[model samples]
Target chain A: MASLPPKHRLQSSAADSAATGQHEHHRPRGLMRWVLTTNHKEIGTLYLIFSLTMFLIGGVFALVVRAELFQPGLQLVQPEFFNQMTTMHGLIMVFGAVMPAFVGLANWMVPLQIGAPDMALPRLNNFSFWLLPIAFTLMLSTLFMPGGAPNFGWTFYAPLSTTYAPPSTTFFILSLHIAGISSILGAINIIATILNLRAPGMRMMDMTLFVWTWLITAFLLIAVMPVLAGVVTMMLMDINFGTSFFNAGGGGDPVLFQHLFWFFGHPEVYIMILPAFGIVSVIIPTFARKRLFGYASMVYATASIAILSFLVWAHHMFVVGLPLVAELFFMYSTMLIAVPTGVKVFNWITTLFRGSISFEPAMLFAIAFVVLFTIGGFSGLMLAISPADFQYHDTYFVVAHFHYVLVPGAVFSIMAAVYYWLPKWTGHYPHLRLSQWHFWLSVIGVNLTFFPMHFSGLAGMPRRIPDYSLQFADFNMVSSIGAFMFGLSQLLFVVIVIMCVRGGKTAPAKAWDGAEDLEWTVPSPAPLHTFEHPPQYRPVEH
Target chain B: MVNVVEDRRPQVRRTVIKTLVVLAGMCVFAFALVPLYDVFCQVTGLNGKTASSAQSLVHQEVDDERTVTMQFVTRGAAGLPWRLEVEERQIRVHPGQSAEVHFTFRNLGERSLVARAVPSVTPSPASLHLRKLVCFCFENQRLAAGESFTAPLVFQLTRDLPPEIKAVTLVYTLYPQENDTVTAAMPDDGKHIDAVATRRWADRSSGGET
Candidate 1:
């Protein structure tokens, strides 16, 4: 119906799926297929499902933490257990929920968007995806261990995490090692796929921002995940090997541990959010029916942000008694980051200006991400001031600032990506009424949970504590209620996803009006192998 | 299709190898942070690990015009059974002049115990210029049951101490050690784990900040 090459490719892909399905039917069925299958789509589905499950698990831990903080006294859990909840919540959310979800999205979309048949190394993809559950299992099992799970907070600052840590700290480190291996391997696979598999005519610049951002994100993952592995390994040595890497009495400084953790930590945050920038870039333009404004600038801005991420790691350590010169240097470098971040915000807004804007669920989430993420950005700038950081560091304000970025920024963007692509994945249009409800409830719940934290933090409530002074009572109660509301509202998201996947009105190949990517060129529920031959890329006339 | 897939395999292998190399390098770099952090601190004196020998304590003329109140504070960690107290609560000393302070420690516990006193000076900027000639914190102290001992600390604040600082506090927290060694909880947040060292400074002209 279209042109010769695409038509031929589609026919062959359909035949390919049918024949493969027949062969798959003859092979060991059920879980064996998932365990051994090299199909990108199936593996992507596994990753997405796994991340969703982890999301719920991490959410429960968060609720437990909020519940205990509901009152001044310890209400639901002991102090140590509360610490475990806070620690595990941070670990599971960052590693299990956010990182894997981004990787899952990359697994599904990177090859399709780039006109590749599958991931560059399909078997490696399966290995990476499977390693996650094992790592998390080992980590979660530590909760039941004799000494309990890691309770030193997720940042796991030294002296706290090293000498005085629980016995389960070794398990936590090993689990992180496993997880880091998965991330590094996953990053390698993504880099290979994006570099090697692009269609014949598609220029690097012409690729979707999602793919571009991922290419950058993959590099970041490769660069920093090993640093995480290395740092945790050093922590391991310090714990058991009689190494005084962070022991002051052994002539090692504790502040050195902060330096290493934040070096990995700062880049890790960008790894979660850069892909978010790419996703928002794609969705905002599509729903606005406008060519993304200043596409070149957007790409440069992302690169700048990545480059600047390394320079700002020391900013997190201002209160650790850095020299005055070092403090001033870190402060200026941190504030300079606001310049490139402003460039990105300006570009997104410019893309939305005077266009045929629509209010789909995806757009609503994207819009909210822009607004709320900026609020987080403003708070971050406020924290960058060295003197001010002394007041805000380790406080609820820090908690609120990160949540605003993560829950509303990174987590919200993932929801946006899912809603935007669900029709294509399921071959069924999403139930709009349900999705809208999910979006509104999520936006409301996110704000309610994180907003009051700013005030509490400002009023001098330190984080990672089981109980706060009575002064923080009212705000904690409101935050806990909001957290529960947010947790419950996500069930609606599950319902929406399940309902769409099961059956609904069929969606056409072009699910949305403004869709013009290579992915949309294929039929809905893209055949097992969508692009056996590279799809032709023709520039659209402006 | 078969040809294309086969041809790209080596390229994929190459990128994968390259990425693995980067990953390995980063891992090595991470472990490198240990010595790197040490060198950084040594160069900058940022971590407050002062090297008295490295500093050339030239005799800059004493500031006769201004006198700063030097205070000694002693705190016992929660688990510590030793009662530690400073001999002099406060003293007035001019910049560049050496001062000696005494602290008394008594083993209140029934058993003989090993205690280590870790010293910290604040405001921290002044700690950089405040050099110690001899300190009891440099060694471990063992006290028999009911035994009491007094240890002396001799230090001089260099003339480089900022004019704004009219006072300085030197705190020594006595921590009970195990197996003849102090625990690793010496730096940052000493209050939580074992003993604590908190030095408070209040300029006479300016009100107490804390």
Candidate 2:
């Protein structure tokens, strides 16, 4: 491959694309380009920026919620609006922020890593990216609707969500349907891209952990997003038409809604986090200057986690009066998930074992992800025990568990990925001093915000409540303050990305010395068209 | 380059379409869960919604010495504008014998309201053992403005009810049906038959209790 000469190879590939007249790089200039272009990179940029905007909007909702909960009394918003705040915050953060952020990363990274020219279905990619804003706009518009937004919580358990829902509930369901459609289409596009568009030499097993992880994540998305659409459609029928699917008088069972919801909801959790596993796998090894330990086992572990995710949704409903056998089955399956998860944690640690480690900003975030995500895993295990879950379910401890997993587990990996790939995307190294400051403040602020939740939850504080007894006031105050600090710190991340994108210090093609992937082989600030002809592959020994 | 990708287009199209078809099928399957849930409940008697009116009565020996404390709880759905209170909040019932409790529902809203009550049994396993011989939940009640009516819930605890469950709570939630005037706009099918069948199933499931 080295004998072919880089200049000649590039010339031939460029000639090949130009002769076809398909690589005509002239595009519609200005906003029209974004609105109409089918380029994967442009669409990925749109997905990412859109998610970041949602994150900020959702963050505002969270801050309003925290401000109200700062003291025992409702000092800011009314209780009803406060309910709306919490509901919108959970919905936006889960669907609009975290999930899309991961998908955005997949869109940018998977094609580059796999040595493909672009996503398999570039047009569908644009469609997926565009649906998000329309869906989210419709969802956010509900806040101004006659009865305000959904106050039944994001889970939207039935009877409450069905018969008592606001008139806007129909719109909310429609918006969810649109968003679900976006996700399903996005998943299909990813699956097609991964299966059919890989470079000739890159076998399934030869791909990086990120590519493998996305393949599985896309499959999970395809499998479950439709189920969510299904459940919401039933909610629509119950609210508008006369259907007792979840009505007891109409011979419909309320618990059946929960069953159907969690069946989708459980795997939904993994859909958000499995990609984090992939991002961490890439970052930790690069920083550690070592090949990822237990590479095959890591793949197997990811697959097992995905398979087990389907079995463990009922762990969320232990307090709903499940029979002993059902409880035990869900309990045992939930605990079994811990095994593959443990394998992943152990693999990351082993990869870091006394290797030539360097503490860059991305590495810092990746390391934090490992330590904090494990704490989350431990709390998850505690909740998995059916007997203990009876005490923990719906409590702030449950709140603490998920936030620890999501904030540090998923969100941190996203930060690390941005930092890790910023140079390649922007052709400039990020401002290092400010980057470090952003990372530390975020870590501290996150702990401050969520750590006290454990104590309050164990002391009998239920979640989704605006007011609490005087005993919880002090902890709530601490949590609220921490939340404000954390929320403000994200502004620094925005500043850093802006400063970097404006050209800080020019970076080379291979941004990091130890980084060894197809992405690094391309020039910094990757061109609009990449890998038009698949790049030749060279096998590396561990 | 165009030919290379174009050559593979049909296969990719097939795969994409197949994936989409699977997604649509899954959505349909989700709707299917409604009927599936009903069938599952009927089979296991899991949700206290076993509406099969074809059961032959099994008269087991009455356990006169055994009594279970049954609590009745009532709640009004939002916008229902109804005040609901159980005439008797708690009752002691003997196994294999029927019991009746009355609930007073007063529609405070200044309009004719059609409301239906839905019931749930707690300690869920107990659902299989508690049989409803006559319950207000069997049909929708249409109440005029300011109308107050006392509806009765007649039920029994079977002798086969596990001895471990000494207490069971039955909660009835009142939801105002979509305004009866709105039904005229919808295509009229014989939905009346479902209500009738539901009542008949309730009757046969607990036939001899009264």
Scored by TM against the true chain B, the candidates give: 0.74, 0.73
The digit string of per-residue lDDT tens for model 2 on A164-245 reads: 7889999999989988888888899888888887777878888889989988998899889988988998899988888877
For residues A1-542, could you state the per-residue lDDT of candidate 1 as single tens digits? Answer: 00011122234655565655565456556679779878778788888888999999999999999988888997789998989999999999999999999999898889889888889888899999999999999999999999899999999999899888999999999999999999888989999999988888888888888999999998888888878887788789989998777776555668778888898899899999999999999999999999888888888888988988988899999887677788899899999988988988998999899989999999999999999999999999999999999999999999999999999999999999998888778877778999999988888888989999999999999999988999999999999999999999999999989898887878787888987788888877666667776778786532
Question: Which docking class does model 1 fall in?
Answer: acceptable
Compared with the true structure, what per-residue lDDT tens digits does model 1 show for residues B11-73?
988888888788778878877777787676556555655542212234778888889898888
**DockQ for all models:** 0.39, 0.43
> How high is the TM-score of chain A in model 2?
0.97
Candidate number of the best TM-score? 2
Look at candidate 1 and tell me the lDDT of residue A450: 94
Candidate 1 — what's its lDDT? 0.82
RMSD versus native structure for model 2: 5.4
Q: Clashing residue pairs, candidate 1? A: B77-B195
Model 2 lDDT, full chain set = 0.83
Counted clashes in each candidate structure: 1, 0
